[model samples]
Target: MTSTKIIHEKKNSDMKKLLGILLSISLLLAGCSISDKNKDLSQEHLVLSTIWFQKSPEAKALFYQAFNIAKERVVEFNKEEGEKPKAVVVDLDETMIDNSPFQGKMVEEGKPYNPEFWAEWTKLSQAKATPGAKDFTLFCDSIGVEVIYLSNRLTTELEWTMRNLDSLGFAFVTPNNFLLVDETSAKEPRREKVAEQYDIILLLGDNLNDFAEVFQHRGDDWGVSVVEKYKNEFGRRFIIFPNPMYGDWEKSIYNNERGLNENEKFKLRRKAVTAF
Candidate 1:
């Protein structure tokens, strides 16, 4: 055969092989997809993202950096000095603790969140600390600053929540210091509880609510305005961790209404996205 004809045939063969490989991968992904009657496109994407986010070394490193920054600011705030005891409030899930397993099970088992499943998961008391959390909280303890946990986890879940925190060697994790969700999830009242006892120097969490009430049910305009207003406080007094799994940020789309089905929420989320 002529050299040009031979080269052309080889190129064609390579293209065919590549196409075959791509087709196989496409089919594999298709097989992974669920065909539930209540399909919402974001679930698989969120699950995969959560897995990657929780397992990645980058995530661990980011937590390390955030905690380190928190440490530095604590020192500065301490120097400023007041008789009020210094305290730092931290959120539990996705902040101090990793709850990716619960999220993973939801995707793996082809299930959506149910109170029963969530309660069971918390009761297991199996969550581990986010990287650097133990060290940071312990550092706070050594520095004479109280470490308080203010979480949206119901007050009823305290037993396992404390067990989980204790197992992870979290410092200053006591019944007196761990504030759970009460009459409201706004967390302000709980935050106020802590405020009365100590001068809250820092707040850390994955959700913005972990910081304050302004973030809860934050509509589009209000959310943007407040964030812009407190822009400087982000990494300073408000240290935030990444949470790809879930948060109030997700709830805002549906306006905190529990009545919306997955499909309806999905449609709203689609409309909510701003594309150029």
Candidate 2:
């Protein structure tokens, strides 16, 4: 080969090597991102999914602040010009109780949530209280505001839930107060029942459905329309707990169909994102 041709070939070879290294680094970083996402979004790595709960000091502070604010609202509402039976409705999971440990155990055991899986976890009845949850309930009880647990947890888990709540120092917990899932997960009927007796001054929940049934089976807007409709109620009468770990919001992008396989969900979620 000519000397010039030889140098040109060597330069090309060097450039190719550099490009290969850059491509490798890109793939490596992409792989790391995928791994972290799997840990966060997949059932197999459910414990790692809740890293936000364990790692984020802001989340802990938010819980404390949310409950404190709820207490303040309760006090204010009690002093309002209403003589009806006053009550504060609350969701159990991820709101009053921190079930991150249960999620961790399920992940560790390579188990996904099923009827049996949930029954076993609730039967253990050892979920810790969310930050300030106990105090918030206590404050409500002290002020004579009946604390009602309006959970989506099935009726079968009622006993376990009661035991768990009592163990966690939650006050005003009883069969009458803990309204479990009946014919529907909408919770509107149960909430209406509670309303029949007590004026629901506040509804505390992690998911939007806990507040109203309109959020159920919502579209890509993710109940944004309904929220806008009742925009004033939020942070006033509807105190929400942060629960990005899992909720209907994630399902909203994928049409809220739970039957979609993991890969299908992934595709839908990716498509739902906004990028420049």
Please identify model 2 stretches exceeding 4 Å from their true place.
1-49
**Local accuracy of candidate 2 as per-residue lDDT tens digits, 65-94:** 889889889988888877687999999999
RMSD of every prediction? 11.7, 9.4
Candidate 1 per-residue lDDT over residues 55-142, each given as its tens digit: 7888889899999999998888877767789999998888899888888777766577888899989999998888899999889988
Q: How high is the lDDT of residue 202 in model 2?
A: 92
Please give each candidate's TM-score.
0.81, 0.80
The lDDT of each candidate is: 0.84, 0.84
- Residue pairs clashing, model 2: none
